[model samples]
Target: MIIGVVLLLVFFLVNISIGSVYIPIPQLIHGLLGADLDKASWETILFLYRIPKAITAVLVGISLSVSGLQMQTFFRNPLAGPYVLGISSGAGLGVAIMIMGGSALGITFSSSSNYMTWGIWGIIISGSLGAILVLLLMSLTAWKIKDSMTLLIIGLMFGSASGAVVSVLSYFGNAEDLKLFTIWSMGSLGGISGTQLEILSIICFIGIIPVIALLKSYNAMLMGERYATSMGVNIKSLRWAMILSTGLLAGSATAFCGPIAFIGIAVPHLARMIFRTGDHRILFPASALIGSCFLLISDAISQIPGSAETLPINVITSLFGAPLVIWLILKRNLSSEF
Candidate 1:
């Protein structure tokens, strides 16, 4: 626990310390401690932009990791992740609808109002609606089907459906809106603001608290459904709670971060490999810490060296995560009896 906490802090510091402009640690700390801000452009950049960006990275990391771990535990599939299942696709679909359609719907904004607030809420509402819709469809087939692989296929189909809609929406959108949408889809941690960050914190903690509170049930769940029932777990109710939690974490992160890829799926594997246990108690928090570290590192790299330009956070994550995922699959296949 101490190691995890320390790593979280280290990564967070790195995230805050490095950006398009360089701000020394001492100066950054002084500013954070309310010192006079009378220095270089880097100081202003650090206090105003990089700090918020880093915080967003931490929150996004926690949300995606927790969501990924829960989905893996719920499905009993090591490969299950928010990105893989298309939950982010739902969130993407939601974001596309809002940024593209908001003008037509007269959801115009004043320069004085918080645009981040509107964007965050729009993503949450749209993403949650899409995620819940998919969940409901999955629930309808839950009792009638017992095949995990088949269920995975259904989830993929739902995700593809959401993606198809997003493509069509893009097709008819004006060039300006399409450019905006494309940039958003590339993703970043810099987009979230202070107020919006608080909202995300509240929603993500509300969802994750229940899953942590039900640790014993999740442990039992890992032992298999029949065994879990033998031990008096309320299988049906538990399923709903897990689904709700996944939606809240996955949807909110997706809404804000613009569909970050791989951390949800990748972090859990890293956690498991480190802890060498299937225990959710240890795995949950471990995943959160590792997930945060992974994203912070990615964000740090996204800030190009000696240049004012930075790559998208999403692009960096995929570059790292995709290879890890491929390696895991190949390792699993090599050991499989089939």
Candidate 2:
């Protein structure tokens, strides 16, 4: 835990420091501490942009990582994640409908009301609804299906269906709207700001709190349902909690930052691998910290430190995460803690 915290702070500072216009670490600290900066623009850039982006990256990491850990435990499948299981895709579809297909539905923002005001909430609400809907569908199948792999495939199918809908919507969408949706789908950490950041932070904590409160129950869950039932754990309520947490965490992040991939699935495994434990008590915090670091690293890389160009945050995550997934597949004895 101590190491994770230290790493998180280090990565966060690094993330903030390594942007398009570089700032020395000492000056960065001085600026943060209310000292005059060498350059006035550096202060503006640090306070207004980089800090918020770093904070957003951290929230995205914690939300997705913690949510990913919950999904892995709930399904008992190594591969289960928000993106792989269709939760993100569902949220993406909802956002797509709101952003791209809104005109078709006769929804329009008046000149007096800019998009940021009403649009942000619309995206969050729609994304939440979509995530909830898919989780409910998965829950129905979860009880009946004993095979983990089969359940994962079902989740993929759900994601595919949602993706198909998004594609159809995209095809008929106005060029400007389609471009907006496309960029959103690619994912972003720098997009969130002021009010949106607050909402995301709140939603993530709401999702995380339940898991923290139920750590013991999650540990029991890993021993098998029959074992958990014998121990008087309420299986029904546990599932619902997981659903609620995952929905809020995954949905809100997707809604605000776009559909980020891999962090959800990859971070939990990284936590397990590094910590060498299956205990939710340890894994939960560990995943959150490692996930934050991973995201900060991704965000820094996306900035293309030496260049003005920045890649979509999603591209970096997938590029790094895909190989980890492939490695996990090849090494069948994953999660030694399990």
lDDT of each residue in 96-197, candidate 2, tens digit only: 887777867765432225476766567667777777788778878777875556767898899999999999988888776777678877888885678878
lDDT of each: 0.76, 0.83
**Cα lDDT of model 1 by residue, 192-219, tens digit:** 6768788888888898887898888988
| Model 2 score (lDDT) | 0.83
In angstroms, give how far residue 100 of model 2 lies from its true place. Answer: 2.4
By summed lDDT, the worst window of 10 consecutive residues in model 2 runs over: 107-116
RMSD for each model, in Å, please?
3.8, 3.3
Q: What TM-score would each prediction reach against the true structure? A: 0.84, 0.87
Which numbered prediction scores highest in lDDT against the true structure? Answer: 2
